[model samples]
Target chain A: MARNRVGVIGGGQLARMMIPPAVELGIDLRVLEEAEGMSADLAATGVGDYRDLDTVLAFAETVDVVTFDHEHVPPAILRELVGRGIPVHPGPDALLYAQDKLQMRAKLSELGLPVPDWAAVESADELGVFLADHGGRAVVKTARGGYDGKGVRVVTEASGADDWFLALAEDGHGGALLVEELVDFRRELAQLVARRPSGEVAAWPVVETVQRDGVCAEVIAPAPGAAGRVAQASADIARRVAEGLGVTGVLAVELFETTDDRVLINELAMRPHNSGHWSIEGAVTGQFEQHLRAVLDLPLGSTAPREDWSVMVNILGGPAEGTLQDRYPAALAAHPEAKFHGYGKAPRPGRKVGHVTVGGDDLDDVVYRARAAAAFFEG
Target chain B: MARNRVGVIGGGQLARMMIPPAVELGIDLRVLEEAEGMSADLAATGVGDYRDLDTVLAFAETVDVVTFDHEHVPPAILRELVGRGIPVHPGPDALLYAQDKLQMRAKLSELGLPVPDWAAVESADELGVFLADHGGRAVVKTARGGYDGKGVRVVTEASGADDWFLALAEDGHGGALLVEELVDFRRELAQLVARRPSGEVAAWPVVETVQRDGVCAEVIAPAPGAAGRVAQASADIARRVAEGLGVTGVLAVELFETTDDRVLINELAMRPHNSGHWSIEGAVTGQFEQHLRAVLDLPLGSTAPREDWSVMVNILGGPAEGTLQDRYPAALAAHPEAKFHGYGKAPRPGRKVGHVTVGGDDLDDVVYRARAAAAFFEG
Candidate 1:
């Protein structure tokens, strides 16, 4: 029999978490990491630049299907893999929207999907016009290379983006910045969807996500008070986005729930995202496993929640001095029901080194347990 | 901050299943496999003789604690590891009972545990006397190196053991055979328990185990009709057995439910056993993760069931042709709620290759789904 091999580019927590499900399903998962001893060290078969065509081609030759741990892999590299007949999930055409925010905003607008009023601006003078039209405050972001609060800023004046304009001009290739009206969002939510190359798509329940300083801090599955209209709207919109963009594998659509109860698209991720982390322990089929099955074109598993509620909290920065292992005893003993996951990265301020998930019938207890378990790691 | 390394000394399906949990908990698990291309090929770091002291010593030096994928490792090698100050959970003192059935029966008797009537006979003449005393019928078993009904026999007359007696006598060292009066049991049960070196112990709800040709065929958690007294009896027995034997890791106590309403000890295993496989999807913390914690002396996690019912069906022999992966598409599509686990073993008649687990509020539906999913691979 032939081997069921799935290759992943870039090594991070998403790649690391994929190992367990791959092992369970008897899939041989290989990772082309950025460097040696990255988060997905166990499955990392080689270390090289994901952006290098030759390096990525060599790695792609060894596996049946090519996927990503992150969306930073260049379009040329992914296109090359597809050209050589190597299957790539979330193929380049769909990934373009995720790679460049301006493209995503434009595509969502074209699809008539609800989103914050946005525009693609090439200069500070254009941004000044948008900011002036939107009550003098707007969110400005780079078209590419942005995540976890980087490459983004809130500009109250046109001069606020002058420095970014200068940096964009310094580079050889010209790039446009994405500008948007400062949304009056009551809270943040995320909708996770997995689509197969065969055109089958599955959507998990909408989850409420909390951000601290533009970084994801916590997630609550099946967002409280989001049962009737809001949940249905997000699932419908995300599924359509997946189909309209011809995406394969998992797609994460970040959303904004306005104070007036409207749900709007916020951002997009073409691989396993932080908002679905709770599924590993809370759902019948986890995102990592579904991602593998989707890329491999096998039938997807159930996405039904195993409990009434599940709360996931990221272990940011880890311990101030010791390793994450040092705190296992204390944290585990205190919250025996909490599921702990560590990324095996060194302690750094605001770096996501691990996460904890707790599921139960009581939402408050689950949230508290997840928080208490995670607190032990951040000294 | 020290690396939490748990070394396993065998590389069968048991060791293979441990990989997922180790990965989830961030424990660096290394396996010393007996041969190449075993079920745990991914984690097998050293391919050598587990019976050879030097090979085991070299492997032992790299990890913080030592455990087993099977109970076949010699006691001397385990004690040597302890002498060298390396931790060996279910250390030599406890593993002896599991390795030798006669020793286990004697110890359980000494502890006032409920067990079938049994005696050790060194020759066929002694066997005759025992058979004459026990209703002219008895079950004879070779105490050492026996598993999966390989060294067990049922006899209506003493001469059924004549061949075994000759084989035992041909060897340089004479060995005794254990003889027992076959209990008229109605069903089989198993109790799974995990204990840390610090004396903390936790047991899952007793489960009903079904056997076919002496191989585990299926398991149902919280065994039906065993909620009150029977459940308490089994948990009490298994915990006492773990504490009595000075066991550090997981212990599986296979029990028999007599027609007259009594639970009797049937067998004992010192590591993760097939009966508890349902815990992977049914319980809050699976047995593999708990075993790593128990062996490492870290606090044990919760054993609470995540659902009301869970049924696990073993896929023996896998497909008649092709690999287990070949059948995944059809099986997964038919039973999307079922969880499939493959051990990476080739298809062979009566060999355990994989399993399927289904958990829900209804027992009959869970059982049907588990069986239907497993059926997809048997052909």
Candidate 2:
């Protein structure tokens, strides 16, 4: 009996989590990794460059399907792999919408989805027009590449757009720039869904995420009091986006929940994402496992939360004065309920090194424990 | 900061499950494997004979603590490692009781714990005496190094004991044998507990285990319909044994619940045992994490069941005809509530390759789904 082999393009925590399910399902996993110390380093056959066609082909030759760890893989390479009959999940067309914001906004607008009043603007004059239409304050973002808060800028006046316009022109960027109304949002939330090749889709409970300095700090699953109408709306929007885009893996829809309780689509990520990391221990089936099952065209598992409440606290790297384990005993002794996960990364200020998850009957207790445990490691 | 490294002396499923918590706690783990392609092969470093003192010493030099994945590690080797100041948890003295059944029974009897009436017999006359005193039947077992129904025989009459006596004499293995009156037991159960070096111990709910041909097939946490008195007695016995023997790790006590509802001590394993595997997903804190914390002298976590019930079904290797993934879709499609875990080992008939865990409000539903999912994989 031959196992279905899966080839992943990068070696990271996303790829690492996929391994547990791949082994469980008897799927032979092979990873094309850039370094020796990455998360999937133990399982992958190191392939130095993802851009090199020969290297990519060599890695794909041994597998039945090709997927990715991050969105940094070049689309041309993915298209080439697909052309050679290597089944690439979240194929180039669907990935393009996630890879390029200009394409995503245009497509969502066409789908009649609720998005911030936005337009692709290539020059200062175009940016001025967008700002004038939306309270003379707009968010200018690069259309092709950006993550977290990078590659985005808030411009309240027309004078501040000149430098970005010149940079885009000098870079010879072909993709149109985007401008959006700076909507006053209460908080950011994520609605995640998984779709298989057979069109079976599963949606996890919507989660509200808290960010500090543009990096995610905590996530509260089911988004507290979001059970009846609010959850239905968020899940419905995410399901539509997944099916409409023909996404064949985990899709994370980052949304803005305005004061009016309306969810506006913010961005799309086409693989196991950081926003869904809490699912590893909180949900019935984790996002990484769901992604593998969906992409492999297997039956999807339940996405229900095992507990009434769960909170995940990100452990950002802090000062390098002591060992992480020094704080483990204290944190575990105090909380005892927090599930800690470390990525084995060196500490560097502001870097995401690990995370802690806490679940219980009380949402406030879970949130407090998770946050305190995370703080212990960071401090 | 140096992390506490633990070197386990076997590479089976027990060691495999330990990897997750070890990695989570940033505990550097190294396994001394007996063969290639074992469950913990990915994390193992040295492959050598576990009985060899030199090999054990070489493996021990790299880690701060030495633990066992099985009970077969020679007592002499353990003593040698301890003599060199290597911290061998469940130290040589505590492990002796597990390695030798005669020693275990004698110790439990000395402690005034209820055990089957038995005697170490060296001749056919002694066995005949033991059977005559009972009901013309006796269970003969080897004194040392036995597992999974091996090294045991049932003699129904005097004639049945003659052949066994001849074989024992021919083998020149007069190293004491045991004959016991077979007690009428209703069912088998297991209670798991963890002990820190600081004398802190915590016990999980007693669980009833179902066995097939002496192999554990399923485990029901808190043991369905188990009397509150029996549960408390089982835990009390396990805790006292751990503290009395200075066992500093997770210890599993397999018990026999008789017609009178009295729990009898059957077997003892001073490491993470199969019966506690459900704790990985069903409990507030998993057994592996608890064991790590205990061995590291950290405070033990709560062992309360997250749900009212948890059932785990062992996935034994079936006939090697179709791919394991062939059943993945079916098993997953049928039971989305099942949490499947598979060890990365080549399948073989009767081998415990993995297990499935299910948690819910009802034990019957959880057990049925778990068993059905496991059977699906086997088929």
Candidate 3:
């Protein structure tokens, strides 16, 4: 029998979460991990540099299709994999937008998608002009290599990104920083969608997300009171972003719901994002399972919510002294209904080590339980 | 931080299913498989004879606790591990009952548990007397090594188990065959429970199980029409059995719901059983996760059902000509809400290779979808 195998390019928690659904769907998932004892260690068949074309090529050869754990796999390597006739989901063509914020801004603008007023500034003078045109303050982000609040800065002056500019010049690879107006928004919302190569798309309801220290802290599914407009607009924008970018696999479109009721794209992720983690226990089909189906070009599962409310809270920085297991007794005893998920990693300050999700009829109660369960891991 | 690791002694589908929850719970699970490329091959750390004390001990010594995928491990090896102070859930004494039908029946009878009239017959003449007393119709089963109808037989004559008796005599081991009066059951129900070493217990809703040729063919959670009496009786029976046998981890109590409004013990499994598989997609906490917690002595999760109705149907004798993936396109497209699960195994007649579960408000629709989805694998 010809077993269908899907190869993942990075060994992060995303890859680890995919193991369960893949196992259930009977898809043989193998991972090309970045290092030993990584999150997806069980499925890590090979540990080597993802940048090294030869190492990735060897791993890709063993599977029917290749997907990703993150958007960091060098586009050059991904293009090479495609050149060799190995299928890559969210192919390099679409991935370029996710890899570079400047590229994403240009593409979204060109596609006429709703996005913040932005410009690619290669010099301080350009950044100054954009800042003056919008407000004295703007958000400055490096074109590449940023995640979980890093590589992002709220700049009041052109000199705010002076260090980043100096580093860019030192690297000898000329690149521009993406500068955008810091739009006043009511709240942050995210729309998660999965697209198959065959153009089939499945979108979950828009969710409200709370950010602390620029990292995801909590998510409430369906973005309460978003039934008529917010939900419709967010889903539409996400579908457009996924279709416009020709992205395959899960696409998370982070949106800023302006004070004036306008929805604008804030960030784009071509892989399963933190905003969709609640779906593991809330949705009929989770983002991880849906991502696999999209990448494999299989029929997508239902995206219906299993309950009225599903709340997910991130367990950041884990424990101050011990592992997540040290707090399991207290957390588990407190909330048996909340599903606790821990990534196998040492606790580090500001690190997203795990998450807790609670789904039920009452949003307030669900939110409280999820937060209370995750709080146990704080120490 | 100290990591909690649990070692499993078998590498069947049950072991494979446990990997997902272990990953979610952040428990390190290592399996000692019986062969290369088994269902739980992803977690297989060692492959050796489970009957061998050295092999079992070496594997058991690495983890915080020891459990099983099946109840086939030798008692001597398990006792040796217990002697070495290794935490073994459903320890040797408990497993012995599951291993020997006569022992289980005698113990249950001694405890005054509800069971059919039964006796242990060593010879054909003894069996004849018992059969005559039971209106010349009795169910005969070997004392040990029985599963999925392999070691059981229904006889109307004295010579029905003559061959088994002959083999027992030839082996030079004195053992009696377990015989019981033919049960006129209205339906079969299963009560699943998880018990910790500390004596905490959690029980899922009793589920109606359909058996085809002595193999679990389908399951309906909460057993339709079993609200007041049947539900209470089944749960009480299961808890008593678990406490009486000193069983830990998940215990499956298969019951015969007779036409006369009586529930009798049919069989006992000291680990996660096929009857509880539906909980993976339907319950607030799956049996696999509950089993892991029970074995590790952690607080158990809720056993609440997530939906109104969740129907599960087994996929027996998977595609004969191609892999399970060959039928995925059709099955997946037709029933997107139905969760498909395939065990990584080759197709063989009457072999359980996979299952499909559908959860929704309507039982009839859910049952139809689950069965239809599972039928696509028929070859």
Candidate 4:
């Protein structure tokens, strides 16, 4: 039997992580990268814009299935690929929900799933009315092209929404805005699920992710005391979302665990998310391999944790005065249990260059060791 | 602090495994390969004969420490490098034991370690007496350049030794023959230990390795039902052997576990061994990284098992009739708990292509799943 070739649209760490499993499975992987020296640098063949139909089509022609590293690909290009008989995992229709928050919110609300009390707003008057009806403060965001902390703003007064409304109007997105009543949630959590084309789905344990400066700094799997009803609820919700939305690959549901013990859908990502990085060493089957299997329409695998507790800490690039190895011996000597993974990239301030994972029965100890090891590299 | 540069003498999978940790530690790695398209094909900077001093010296000049992927480097070349003040881990004096079986047997016997009774013979008359004393059967082996069932033969009849003795006499190897009592052993086990330049040592759990056609098929760490005393004894013996022989870096002591519950020394490898591959995912610190730390005079990490059991199965090349990915979905679908690793090599019958590791609490389940997954790839 011939191996299926997979074409990834971007060449970030997600794409790089995919290479190991792809190579293990003997799959020919070709990445359409936007930059040289990116992760997945060795396997990348086509260097072009993901939004270009011709480049994507040419790249798709050499592979059996088309997947993505990021959700930035234009919907039209994905639609065109699907129209041309190409099997695109998380096809254009599903990706639209991730790309446009308004559409996703509408669909989730219709499905009777819990979401923030949100309203579609076109002007500052509408935003003010929604805020007045709920609370004095509201979280306002552009419906499309927002990531990290960009394109998001908190408004307390009517005049505070003027700049965002004016900007959206200038971009011909007058009606593309979503305002939600900021909830008093306790913490952030993420539930990851992988769904195959055959409708089989698998969900990993819900994890608590600690964010620093809007980037994930650490993740604790099974989220300490989250095994009973919370785990079941999170997994059930993630599986329902995957099946309900027809998501054919890995779906990471960013969730909010409210004080009242409820999980509200915060956002959705259709590829491997940073929150699941711990699974590479902590789970029975890693999310990267599961993603590939799901996208290829293969049977889904178990997402059980290998240990009682697993912690993942991201290594954010720090000051450029020192090299990574400068702290290697120290970290290895200090925390012998830490499993380090360094991406072959030059360090720059605030860049995500690597991560460390530690697993054991003691959750706090593993988390502490993982964070300390990661800090050694980042600092 | 400057990064330590390591020069490896071979470009097989052992050298390939070193790359990931070297990259993580920011160590500059240079490999002297004999062929192109070897496992460490990308990291190797110079390709040359291990017997050539000039080529070895040139490669040494680019790195801070010298190591080997295999015990094939000529003793003369190693001596030459040592004469030039280049630090060679498992230096010439220590490497001789691993390079020659006769010397190894003599040294182990001198150290009061149990070993098969053996002697060097010249003629069929000498072999006849030796075989007659050992139930009319003896194992004859060349003193050097033997591996994987090659260069060794079992002789049952006195006449069968005549041709070998004649060939030895003709080649001035009259005294280079070995005659040994063929013991009935139950199974083979390997004890892996790493020693640093500073004399610090660490040992992994002794593992039972299953062989097929004289090649390793699988490895089960802590050797099921192996008494704690026996496991510790094996590790202690290996550590003592390493320290006594002034061996640095990782050393694998292969032993024969007899039906009488006696452990006899079989062979020794002074580098990362296939039996320790499970450490990459199953141990706190992988053998490759620990080996690097040891040779570089850095502190070694703990060798605790991350899981209760770890079973590793080799993916031998079966036939070149199908692509590896053809078995990917099936293997993964059937055993999602198995973690697959493949060396990017073109498949050929009986070739050491890659391996899969299944690690968890249930030993029986892990071993069964791992073996089945490996069989799929091999088939």
Maximum-DockQ candidate: 1
**TM-score of chain A, predicted model 4, versus the true chain A, to 2 decimals:** 0.96
| Of candidates 4 and 3, the better by DockQ | 3
Clashing pairs in 1: none
* lDDT by residue (tens digit), candidate 1, B1-379: 5649999999999999999989888889999999998999888889999999999999999899999999999999899999999989989999999999999999999999999999999887899999999899999999898888789999988788988888888986778899998999999999999999999999999999999999999999989999999999999999999999998899999999999999999999999999999999899889999999999888999999988999999999989999999998889899889999999899999999999999988898888888999999997
Q: Per-residue CA lDDT of candidate 2, range B1-379, in tens?
A: 5447888999987887787777666667789999887888767889989988899899999988888888888899999988999888879999989888888889888888878889988777788788999998888888776676777778876556566567667888656677777877999999999998888899999999999888888999879887589899999999988987778899999999998777888888999998998998889888988988887788788788887999999888853666566677778899887887877666788888788999999877888878888888775
Q: A14 in model 4: Cα distance from truth in Å?
A: 2.3
| Candidate 3: residue A41 Cα off by (Å) | 0.7
lDDT of 3 by residue, B300-377 (tens): 999999988889899999988887888988888888888989899888899988899899888898888888899899
For each candidate in turn, give its C-alpha RMSD to the true structure in angstroms: 0.9, 2.1, 1.1, 3.2
Q: Deviation in angstroms for B377 in model 3?
A: 0.7
Q: How well is each residue in B165-271 modelled by candidate 4, as lDDT tens digits?
A: 67768887465577788877899999999998888899998999998877888999878887586797788789878987889999999888888888877778899
lDDT winner between 1 and 4, please give it: 1
Give one digit per residue, the lDDT tens place, for model 4 in A202-280.
Answer: 8999999888877788899988778888888888889888877889889999888999898899889999999998887
Error of 1 at B106 (Å): 1.0
Model 4 interface DockQ? 0.43
Give per-model TM-scores. 0.99, 0.96, 0.99, 0.90
Candidate 2 CAPRI assessment class: medium
Per-residue lDDT over A1-379 for candidate 1, one digit per residue giving the tens place of the 0 to 100 score? 5549999998998999999999998899999999998989889988999989999999999999999999988999899889999999989999999998888888889999999999888898898899889999999999999999998899999888888888889996778899998999999999999999999899999999999999999999989999889999999999999998888999999999999989999999989999999999889999999999999999999999988999999999999998898998899899999999988888899999999999988999888888988999997
Instruction: List model 3 lDDT by residue over A169-281, tens digit each.
Output: 99999788889999999999999999999999999999999999899999999799888888899899999899999999999999999999999999999999999999998
